[model samples]
Each structure stands twice: as structure tokens, then as C-alpha cells.
Target chain A: MSEAIAPALLAPGRTAGMNWRRLVPLLLVAPLVLFMLALYALPVLAMLSRSLLEPAPTLAHYAELAGDEVFHRIFTNTLWTTLVVTAGTLVLGYPVAMGLARARTLLPLLLIIVLLPFWTSVLVRSYAWMVLLGRHGLVNEALLAMGMLDRPLRILNTPLAVHIAMVHILLPYMILPIANALRQIDPSLARAAAGLGAGPWAVFRQVTLPLSMPGVMAGILLVFVLSLGFYITPALVGGPRDMTLSMLIAQRVEQLDWAYAATLSAVLLATALVIIAIFQRAFGVGTAFRMSAR
Target chain B: MTLAGRGASVALNSLEKRYEGFGAVRGVSIDIRSGEFLTLLGPSGSGKTTTLMMIAGFETPSAGDIAIDGRSVVALPAHRRNIGMVFQNYALFPHLTVAENIGFPLKQRGVAKAERARLVEEALELVRLPGYGTRQPRQLSGGQQQRVALARAIVFKPRLLLMDEPLGALDKQLRESLQLEMRRLHADLGITFIYVTHDQEEALTMSDRIAVMHEGRVAQIGPPEELYDRPENRFVAAFIGESNFLPATVRGREEGHVVAECAGSLVRATCTTNPAPGESVTLAARPERLRFVDGGWPAPPPANRLAVTVTEAVFVGERCRYVLRTGDGTSLVLKEPSSAATRRRVAGETAEVAWSVADTILV
Candidate 1:
């Protein structure tokens, strides 16, 4: 009797002739697929097509962008600031992530501090940094009071202000992945390295850092890509000379130069894709996004 | 790999480790000779692993000093102490290949690449993993990974090797095989090995000396046979192996042996601890040292004997084990060869158990 029931159980289609189990998941995801296609993919593709078909199907806009010296300066500025912000986040976030991974009693407190910025709006965070780095602000006032500075430093409305505010906004993005990676590493590896006569620095270089590379890579890619597209933080904190590509694209749209804006957006999208493709080829995406070192 | 005269002697002078006013290891002083294979054998939280960590310099002692070759190394960090440690999890670097993992210490010490390769290859061969240099740690089985961990620890030829339950992760069969392999490696390298394990059989099978720890103290430390045959206290006797502890009253002392009255019978056991007459004592006897007397065979005239009722008789391959209850309801276990003479005694039958004076000790 059990043997007779076994084949019927195995052949579910024999009874219903339909596999709703498989179809249910596809049906469940169909709405998301349609939503993304309608809301995200179509508009982006339509905007990209304008770069080719706009101004009577001429590539003149892209040529103009390439030859324009102001565009070149803003593009270089964007790249430099993005690189600086990415590097700054890495250097500032690594030790905090390491501390979070190893902390026993202070873990929750440190985690809360790392995550506090995420609770606030990005605009608010940028404005807060503007206040802190502004002339006659708290830092300048303190420095002046301490007699350490002869005059108020021009910290706000410069490339330095943009870099600092962007780093502050994107630091949690850098820290969380690295902390997750560091947490996944077995602590025995460090002890084992030490036991084999590697000092603290050697242990970190040999074991801890190498194992945490995936998270580090993830943080770098996320921070760099996000910083490349930063608009309000740079616009609010940056001086006129520190104009970024995103700010320029926004300005072109406001001026009703839709063709130029589309061309610039296409360039930004292409650059992001090329950067991702280079990194993906250099280190497999699987390694970069791996959840655990093991 | 040959070592230089088995490394240095380690002396832990009254080592104490207290965590927030609670003692983890209290007053542990052990003098390990050069090249000695000393195993700190104890149950979990018994301070054996803590003691090993202190010697490895991973944990600082709250008080007391540790010395290598009579020179204090308490202030030295782990890397400067020249000690090799094999963690229970193996702790192999997942990112490095087996060869790179084995050669990591050599690289850290600034050895040339060519020489590092030679030494790594030799270490791999020593651990019986030659030609497996390119394999990742995840590609290997548990036993293979264990061997890689051992190779990595010993490749640097450190003065001492500390293994914290290296075989704890393997199955019983694999653990047994690895125990023999580790013993062989210790012999070949002639380096001091301080091994930690909670398994009694593993300790007995591997170590030249076993320190049985209990409640943050060493209950007994001696050669395996000596520890097994003559444990110092009740904890040691019970922890090292199975034992029957019976409450007894000391009747008298004669020739350094105590005559104790227990379970309506008189037992004469050797007593290192002198108990006055009429004082309460405990007599410990191993099951193998006791046998049942039946009708077919005559009972041996031993110094200690008890009249017990056989409550259960179990056939355990080569032998039969009988759980017996004495007249005063004191339970005892007796083991005898599974011969025709012993097979007749079943549950609910009366039997006379006997043991020699030397086999039973007063604790």
C-alpha cells in the first residue's frame, strides 16, 4: 500500500497535471519584474536613447561634451572627489569596523554610533557638516579660542568641504559590509597566526586583512559608485569651482537643454558600468559580494 | 623535522588567572621538561585550556610567572615566545592555499622565497600531504585540514607546540588514527608538546604525562599508568576512569595500609593519606579489578571482599559486567572474563565479589 502511494506522491502532476509550486514563485515575482521594467528600466533606456536620437539624430552633443573644457574640468573634479571620498571612507571606517567585530561589551554602543547617520536625511547630514565646517563655525571658533589659528579657515564651500560631507554621508555604507565580513572570520585564524610567530601587525596583514578583502571591496564599490552620483551634498557644501558632474547634469536640465543633459547622463551611466565591469573582471563579483570570509 | 634537543623547558610558577575576581586557574604550577609530551586533561571549564593559553602567552596570568629554560618569558608576547599552537577549529587561513598557509610563518620571519618553498614542501611531506600544496583549505576533508593545521604550526620549528584538542573535530575513528599520528610526530620532532583535551582515553593514549584538572586545580599529574593506578584524590580517581567509591570507616592502620569497614565487610587498602581510627574514609576500586565468585569457580582469597546481589549482568564483547548491590544498598560494578564459569551468574543471583588490597586505594 505504501509503495502504491509513493509513486503518486512522487508524480504530483499525475493528480493535478499542474505544478503550482513552481508557478507560484514566478507569479509572485511577476509584479516586481513589471514594476522595475515600467518605473526604472524604461525611463533609463528612453533617456539613454535621447543621447543618440536627440537634435535630429546627431552625436554632436556628446562631441561637444568631450571637447568642452568646463565639462572636462567638472568631470575630472568629480573623479578626484569621488576617489578621495572613497579612500577617506575606507581609512576612517576600517578601524571602526574592526572594533565593532571584536568588541565584547561596547559592540551595541559602537553599532548605534555607526548607524546614527542612517536615521537622518542625507540633506540634513550635509547641512550639518556645512554648519560644522563653515567659517566662524564650532571648529573655527574653538581653534580661534585656542589661539591655534590666526584667522578663520575657509573650510566650507571648497573641495575639502564636499569631500568631508560626502565621506560623512557614505561612511556607514563602507563600515557595515566590512564589519559583517570581519565578524564572519574565525578568530582562531588570528590566534593561529600569532602562535606561528606573526606579530599583531603581521597577523592583520596576513590573515585579517586578506580575509576581509571581499567586504572591503564591496564597501569601496558601493561608496565610489554612490559618490559619483552625489548631487545635493556636493551642491550644498561645494564652491562654484568644485562643481561635480551630477550638479552639471542637473543644471543642464534646469536650463531646458534636455539633449545635453541626456548626453551627460549617458556618459555617467557608461562610466559607472565600465568601472563595475573592470572591477568585476579583476575580482569575480562572487568574491566581492561574498557574505562571509569562509 | 628534527629539532635542537627538543626545545626549552617550561616552568609555570604558581600561575593564577582570575577573571573579574573569579578564579579561572588558581595556583597551577607545572614544570614541563624539555621534549616532554604533557597533556592537560580535564573536562570543560576545568582550566586546562586556560593554563595552555597562559603558557602560549595568549592570556596573561593575573599573578605568577612563566619561564622558558629558567628565564622569565611572562612579559613576552605570543609571537616573540616562539610557540606553535594548533587550535581546535584548525584555524587555517581560508584565503591562502595549503602551501602558502604552511609557509606563512617563514615569510613573516623574512625567509627567502626559494628557501620558504623548500621548507613548506618538507613540512607538507612531514604531515603526509606532499603534492597537495595548491589545494584550498575548503577542498580538504576534516582530517586533511587537521593535518594542514599541524603542518602550519610546526613548519616554523618553534620551541614548543601547543595543541588544543586538535582531534576534537574528527570522528572517533579518525581521532584515534590522528592520535597515533600525533604521537609519532612528537617523537620525530622531539619538541615539547603541551596538549589539551577533555577525553580521558585520548590523553592516556598520547601523553607521556597527564595532568587531571578539576575546579581550576590539578587533581593529579603523573605518568598515565601511575595516574590510572594510583590517583591522589576522589576527583582524580573518578575523572581519570570509572571507579567505585564506597563510604568506609577507618578501623585501624597497619604497615601503612588502612583497614576500613565498609558495606558489612572489612577492606584493607593502601593509604597515602593517614586517617585516624574511627575516622570516615572512601575506598576506590576499579571495576576490572573486581570479579564475582560463583559455584563453578572458587573465589580468590583477596584482602577485600563484599557479599553482593547481582542486579544486572551485561555481556560486553570479551567480558561480562555485573552491577551488584550490597546488603546496605551500596551499588558496585564488577567485571569478569566472559567464561563459562562467569556466564552462569545472572541478575537476581547472589555472588561474592573480591579484589586485591593493591587494587583498592583509600582516598
Candidate 2:
């Protein structure tokens, strides 16, 4: 009995060694996992805790959020402005994406041009927009020179300026993914549709558009999410009345109200996650990631 | 099947297609009668597919006229040409079901809802895929997808149907089955079919008449048996079926036949095309037309005979093929059915191979 049991015990030890070999990779990855848990997840959890339990576990923040008119107006304004900026980016980016995808010789140059602004620091780009959109800027001077305006126009520190800068900065993010998706679609499919008796417009509407939806969805999600957390451009160009959630959180932090700022940051993170979850449920997350990565 | 051949003819008079400086198809002309199954058989780059595409109005002809029922349709678009086409890849829309793909043309023509459903069901049943109407193209097998393409092409019942190697994607057994089904469909529907293929066996098996193309020109056009029996030239002779060619000089002409001398041997062959006496020509004969004759066997009177050594022999299930070499080192392949046992000869043995003058075609 002892001799038989000895081999069985040795077999378990051999199996344990095999399992240890298999898990070596996980052991190697454990450091990065712990770093992310400490640097990213811990701060997020701490913010969430502050949002719920700050000021001796009172519900004052929730009560204030419901009753405050300024917060309500800012929330509505932020949501609508983000939506408008996202829609504007899509409208302006789609044609450029089409051109980039179809143009044979100039596609790389065009892609670089689209991505030129993204390579620069965001604050620097915001400053460049400020110089261009100010009352005494190149645009106002040109309009005045062309007799289209009687004087320098009041363009800076306005919602319009902020929107222009945001769209300019984010358009490439939308266009690149959309162009990648478009390029993957076979041109023969469109010709086949035409041969089957569909006109050009009908072919595009029925085939090209639906087939490129994965790209469009990706562009939309990207532009919307990026617009939600925009800070530098809005702060530099937008008026005080055009303050967004990021600016509000920064202002709270500057006044040394860490608990309030943490609450606001938690709200922003939760809102972004909820929107992403909704999109993922509608269009599969795997497909969305595939499109954007392509 | 009321086939109005005379009134509904498809004619391409000197049609030419040029791309940039290169001529893909130059000066091709043919007349296909309505309801005739005409196949354009050629090797790759012979411009067979270009000719079909020109007929279907996909590629605009750089020169000449294409007419349907006596009306020139040179400038007509593909949709307005009133023709149906089946592509090589099947080209089924992946998003649409089989029923929707079949019903597309009817829907474009604005057929009513009830009639469209009935017609879709009928087309599905015609392709023997009645219950697969709701399945997408990606869900079906390759052969089933090809049948869906066929149903889509014929669902509208167009006057002319063009197929560009439609069964080229299927395996051998499936391709043969589809070829027979297509022939039966053509006979029942009485629609003109213009098929393009590089497969000689397929053309011989299914075509009412075959147009053998070479270098953008119709080398020869005739019924299957006619083209096989009496080819007009060397190209046509070698293209249609397996034939052995021996370079010979015409010695004399009798009636329409020619007496020729090939490789220090005298032979008699019938001239399908006019070749002057004393002119060098190729004597072509089908492999199956020759037979191994025993030493004491009676000769085929008034036929050409030659004594040769069998260099190689192989049994191919139903038949035995022998490679026989003449005295001048010209090898001839002879095929005989396995049932003939008296004339069986082993390799390296000399035997008399005899074939009738009528079986010989002087090209």
C-alpha cells in the first residue's frame, strides 16, 4: 500500500509542477496588474468613496446637486454642447474620410495633415486657436479688409470659438477610424450593386453606408467620449458662461474643496462609463474595438 | 418554348474593346440565334470574357456595334440592356437572404408585394433550394450559393443571359451536375445563353454550338460534333479535343479527300478546309479513332494503315491507351476500349494501327 501511494503522491507533485509552469506568465504580469490597481483603480475607488461618504457620511452633495439651479444649468449646457461638438465633428470628418480612403497617391499626406494638430500639445493648439479667433486676429482682419465687417469681430471667449477649436482638434480622431473602415470594404461590392440595377445613390445608401456603420459608430463614440472630458481648449477660448464639468472640477480643486472635486470627478467617470456601456450593449464591444484599432 | 430565333437575334458586328493603349478585345464578330446555347471557349487572355462583358453592356466597346433584336445598344447601360448576368464569384449580397437576392430585379422593376413573394418562392424551388430562402449567402455552401446566383439571374426571365464561368468555383462532380441542369434549363426556358469558359470538356458537353476563340478572334464556330470531327485549322483541332497531329505534305487530291505522305509513310485524309496539293499540312486524327489490328486480321479497305511499335501502354479503367512510335520516330496515341481483347499488344511490340479515311481531318 505504501509503494502504490508513493507513485500517486509523486503524480500530484508532477501535476503541480506543470500548473506552476503554466502560471509563470501570470506571475510575470502580476506587477503591472498591481501597479494599475494602485495608480488607477485605487484613486477611482477613493473618489467614489468621497462622493458617497464625505463630510461625516452626510447626503449633502446629492441634496445640493438636486436643488442647485447653477449646477442644473451647467449640466444641461455641458451635455448639449458635447452633443453639438460631436455632431459637428462627424459632419466635417465624413467627407474628409471618404476623400482620404479613396485618393490613391495622396492618402498618406492627407492622413498626416489630419493628424498634424494631434501631434502638438493640446494647450499649444488651444493657444494657436486663441490667436486666430481673437477680436484682433487674422480672421477679423481679413473680414475687415474684404469689407465683410465694419470692425474687428468679438469672436474669442465665446462658445463658437470653443466649438471650432474642439472640432478641429477631434476631427482626425473620427476621420482616421472611419477611413480605415471604409478602406476595408471591397469596391467590387458597390459595382455589383450597380450591376444589379441599383443607381449610384441607391448603392451608397443601401450598401456602402450600412457596411461602414462600424466605422461611423466608432467615430461617434470616440468623439463623444473625448468631448466629455475636454478641458484645455474650453478653458482657454470659452467664456466663463461656457464652463464645462472639467473646468468646474478644476475650480473646485483650486478652492481646496477636495471632497467636492472628487465627487465631480467620480460623476464624470461614471457618466463616461455608462455611455460606453450603453454603446457596447447596442453594438458589440469587440466590433467597436476592432474598428477603432484598425 | 417559342424561340423567335430570326427576330430576337444577338449580333456583335466588329465589336472592339480598348483599355488605354492596350486592346483587350479587338474586332470580334459573332451572331447568336435566340434560344441557342453558345459557349465562347478559349485559353486565358483570349478575350472570351471581354466579349461576354461587352455583350452584357458592362464594358463599353471602343468601336463597332452590338445590337439586340435589330436595335443598336452600344450606348445602353447594363440595367437598360435587359440582360441577366451570373458572375464567377457568385457576387451574392452577403446582407440579403436568398429570397431577397432572387427578388431584387423584380423589386427594382416595381413588382407588387404578393407577386414578388410568389415569384421568389418559385425561383427558390427552381434552384431546388425551397427552404433556404431566408438564409444569408454566407450561411450557405459554395454550390448552394452558385444555385442562388443562377436563380437570381433567371428569376426575371430576361431575353438574354450571360454567364462568366458561373460553375468555375465548384468541384468537378458539382460542375458536371450544374452543367446538365443548365442545359435542361436552357431547353425548357428557351432563353439565349452566352457562356464563357476555358474548360473544353464543359463546352463540348453543354453547348449547342461552340465558338473557339484565339487572340481575340473566333477561330472556328460549329456544333459540338462538327467541331470535333472536322476542325478548320490546327488551333481548332487541338482546342476542341485530344488529337494527334503529324506533319504531312499533300501528295494528291481525290474528290474532297487528300492523299498525303507523312514521315516516310503514305496516308490518306479528308480535307475539311481547302489546301492546295503539294502544300505542307497537318494530318489530324482523334485518338479514339485508331485501333490495334492483329497480323492476320482483315484490313479496313480504303483506309490509311501504318505498322508501328507500341512504346507505352496504360489501362485507364474502361479503355487501354497505347503510345505507338513510327519508323521516323513520330509517336501516335491510340485508344481502344477494354472489351477488345484480340488486338491487345504489350509495350515494345510492333502492331498495325489502322483508321478510316473518313476519320482523318487534314488541317
Candidate 3:
């Protein structure tokens, strides 16, 4: 029995030929890579081709983007509005993130609140904002009752309503990453800082803020990138003069101008890639992805 | 280069620390002299670390006060207290290099850049890492990182330096080397160092005095030799060093010694604390104090002797430790020089163990 078992348990180096057996299962899923190439990559390539080649291969779409006063206004307006919304989301989200990170009893409730809006459709949330921010909505009614305003105020159909709705919707995305980052930081680090002659504000400024940078950068990138692609909220709550690039793309698509719509989509995609590159350069891409994943 | 200022004195007058409803540190009072290297030595959960934290102003005392330089600092924040602290993990900022970490206190004090750099270099050299200022903590070895932490603690020349298990992370060899360096630094600078460590050898190696703590109170506070030679209680005797405690009953008393009957053997020991006649007591003896002899070996000149059978013999490079059982089946350990002559004893052989009355401590 010993002799038989010895042969059965021969050294792994003597049985190197069996190593290929481990790869059999992985080989079975190799076809999924081909499927992605066919379905996802082919569509993206077709979109790129259409953006450049459609309506008689020319750079006119790119050239027209620079001189078109309306397109320039929409682009700049979208950039400024997205920046404002991203900043607003960060400022409002940090305290909530700190609360979630520090308060063990409130974490579950805060998580539910953060995810509650995600449960509904974006269109539904935007419409709900329209109802709340309209001239005769709950806010104006409360303000009139408190004698803060003499009449019902026009808060909806303006950039202010769009900013509020965007910030509210994107707050979860900003907060979760910051909270995850804060959680990874060792509480002992702050204590050590305080023990090593740092006041509360200095500890926050030097240790807490620097250590939580990856989270802040990640939240800003996510909120800013998401805000750039926002469509439904701005359309429902913003005035026609406050239309963003996304709304312009939708208008062109609705007018059956697919070539111009594809050009606008390309511009949006390029802008997002450029912003992401800048963010990745500022803070490592790996850290950003880690924060988002958490 | 030379000691210029007298080190700060630290006094904890009945300091207490509580967490929620539980007291982590009970009433504890200690007076640490200026320019002394004092260590708080204890096992985990003994509240030594909590006491240190309270003195450093990281944790507020629930009941009493900590005074530095004879002034109450209980209400002072950590930064304003001007106490330098080295954490167990070193707690070096990963975002900053060694220079920046060492210069942190100087920056907080608003010291000029040139003066900060000069002091940072001097501190680095004091820890013997003169050229490692540019490296991040992660880039250095554990001992080097620990030195950087020490440098950071002393860069601003704080009068009091608090170290919490600073050498606990290093290996035995590195720890021993750093312990010697710390001793030299303490002697050279004449700075008040309140070090906390559970390692008794480290406390003995570097401290001017050791405060052995157990269960939220100081078991004993004395110089290293005093703690080792004359431990005040059973806990301090066992905690500070290897000690064999034999239950004994006091038979008579001399001028300053107690004659006791231990395990069917008559012995006399110097009393650490006075005990009355016929009172039960414990006779503690250091292992190295116990002398060994072969069964047929002649009696020594003037030492208390007891016959015992060798149960086990262990060769520990520098010493040969023998576990022996006495006539009453009580086990005691004795260490002899690890020469070839001492290795001749075998288990199950009878031997004589002897020590002087002065070396045995009666508790």
C-alpha cells in the first residue's frame, strides 16, 4: 500500500504534464472575449466612423463646432454648470460622508437614504424636482406662509433648479467614495497627529484631508463626469436658454440630424476622456478606481 | 552636543482615565524626576499605555490631573502641552518624507525654514540616520523607520518625550541595538523620556527607573537593579525578572531579616516589607543567585544550602538552567555558567542549590 501511494503522490515537478488541466475551464470562457469584440467594440468603432465620415467625409463638423455661437454657448454653459454642480455636490456630500463614516448607528439609515433616489427612474426624480421647485410648489408655499416671500417665486424653469436637482441626484456618488476613503484611513493616524502636537484643525488639514485626497478626487471626477452627460434633469427643470450640450444632442437627434448628433456625441465623449485623463494625471488612476469600487 | 537645559519633571497626581462606563486607568500617582529615563512596563491591558496617553494629553483623565514642570496640564490640548510622542506604529505620514515628518513640530511652532532644516539634520544624526531625510518611511527598514520616528519626536527639542512601545516592532537583534542607542541618547541629551513597553529587558537596559504596572496600578517603581533585587510584591517579582517563589512561614526575625521554614527547609531572607512572627510569607530568589553543586560535592563556605534533584537541564548558550525539585516536591530553577564543567549534570541526579540570605527576598 505504501509503494502504491508513493507512486500516486509523485512529486509535482515529475508530473508537470498535468498542469494544462487547470486551464481547461478558463479555455471554455475564451469565446466571451470574441463576443465583446463583436457586440461592444464593433458598435463603438461604427459610431467613431459615422462621426468623422458621415455627410461626405469632411472636418466641417469639427470646424463648425468652433464658430457656431449657439453650440459654443451651450458647451461653455454645460462646462460651468457641471463645475458648479460638482462643487456643490462635494461641499454638501463631505459632511454627510463624515457622518456616515464616523457614526456607526446611522450608517445603515444613511446608506438607505443615499440609495433611495437610485431606486426610482431618473425621469421620475427630475419630474419630482419640477413639482417641488415650481412657482406654486411646497418650497414657495412654505416661504409665503413664513412671510419670507410676498408672492410665489419662480424657482423652476431656471438654472438654479437644474443645479439643485443635479447636486441632489449626484450626491450619493460623491459621498460613497469619500466615505470609503475616509474609512480606509486609520483613526490612529489622526490620534497620532494630535499626540504629535497637532491641533484639531491642523490634524484635519494636514493628515485627514491629504489622506482622503483619493476619495475627494474620485468623487469630484465621478460627479463632474456624470453631470456632463446629464440630460433629463436639465431639460425638465432648466429654461430653454439654459440648455446643456446633452440637450443640444437630443434636439439634433430628434430633428433627424444623425450626423450632427454623432459629432456632438463624439465631442462629449472626448471631453469626458480629457477630463478623466487630467484627473488621473493629478491623482493616480488606480487609487481613483479603488475609491469608486469601495 | 551637550546638555544645556534641565529636563522637565512630570507628575501624575491620582490620574484616572475612563472609557464609557469602564475605567481603563484607575487612580495612579507618580513623580518622575527631571532628566530621568523612566519606563512604564506592564503586560497588555495593564493601563500603562492609557496612563502615558493621559500624560501626553491624548486622553483626558476622568478623575485627576497631570502636571508638567509643576503646572497643571490636564486642560491643555496636546499641541499646546509641547510634549513629543512616538507611537508604537511610528505613525509616520506616508505622504511626507522623513525630513518633512521630523520638521512637522518645528513647522507647527512657526520656526524658520533654515532653523528647521538645521534641527532636522541634527535630529537625524542623533538617531544615526544622517542621510535618510529624503526617503519616505516605507522605503526604510523597520529599525530605520523607528529611528526616523525617534528623530521626529525630538527634532523640536521638547523637554519631555513619550514613547509607546517604540521598539516593539523590531526583531530581537535590532531591538537590542536600538535599546543601546536609546540609552546613549538619553544619557547624552539628559532629556526626560517617559517610555512605555512591556518588554522587561528593554526597560532594564535603558531606563533609570521602571514602573511595573499590573491591573491599572503600579506594582512597583524603582531602579532596574532595585526592582530586580527587591521587588515589593509577588507581581513585581514575577513581572520584572525570573523569580522562584517558595511558600514559607516566618519562624523568627533578626535585625532586618526574616528566618522562615520553606518546603521542609530552613532559610533566612531579607524582608522587602516587614512581616510579623508566625505570619505566612513568600521567599523569592533570582535564578542566577542559586548556586549548584554535585551530590557528593563539599559544602560551600557560608551560604544557605538545600538538597534538590535535577529534573531538567537546558543549555541556553550563556547559561545552563536546571529545574530541580526539593524534598517537599517544590520545583525551583537555577542558572549556572554554561561551561563544560556545568554540563556534566544529568536529569534525575541529586544536586545542592545554595544562595546567601541577602540574595533571597522575603515578601
- What are the per-residue Cα lDDT tens digits for candidate 1 across B66-161? 999899988999888888889999999999999999998898889999999999999999989999999999999999999999998889898789
Kindly report which residue stretches of model 3 are placed more than 4 angstroms away from their true locations once superposed. Answer: A1-36, A290-294, B295-302
Q: Give interface RMSD, per candidate.
A: 0.8, 2.0, 1.2
- Share of native interface contacts recovered by each model: 0.88, 0.27, 0.65
Error of 3 at A231 (Å): 1.6
> Residue A66 lDDT in model 3?
80
Order the candidates by DockQ, highest first.
1, 3, 2
Candidate 2 residue-wise lDDT, A1-294, digit = tens? 664455456555666657666677999999999999999998788877886788788778867777878777777777777898999999999889889889899977998898898899999999999999999888998999999999898889989998999999999888988888888777756655666666667777777777777888899899888989899999999998999988998999899887778777877887888889999999865686585432
Off by over 4 Å in 2: A1-38, A100-124, A289-294, B1-8, B295-302, B340-346
* Candidate 2 per-residue C-alpha lDDT over B1-363 given as tens digits, one digit per residue, 9 for 90 to 100: 243442246998998888888777888888989888999999998889999888877788989899998899888777677677888889887667888888877877789988988988887887789988889998998899988888888777777888999889899999999999898878767888999999999999999999999888888898999999989888998988889888888888787778888877788898756677789888899988887655333544436877789999998879888899987788899888776554567899888777888888888
lDDT of 3 by residue, B237-329 (tens): 988889988888888887777888887778889875777778888889988888874422345533567889999988888888889998888
- Candidate 1, residue A94: Cα displacement in angstroms equals 1.3
Which ten-residue region of model 1 chain A has the weakest summed lDDT?
Answer: A13-22
**DockQ per candidate, 2 decimals:** 0.81, 0.39, 0.65
| Docking quality level of the chain pair in candidate 1 | high
Candidate closest to the true structure, highest DockQ: 1
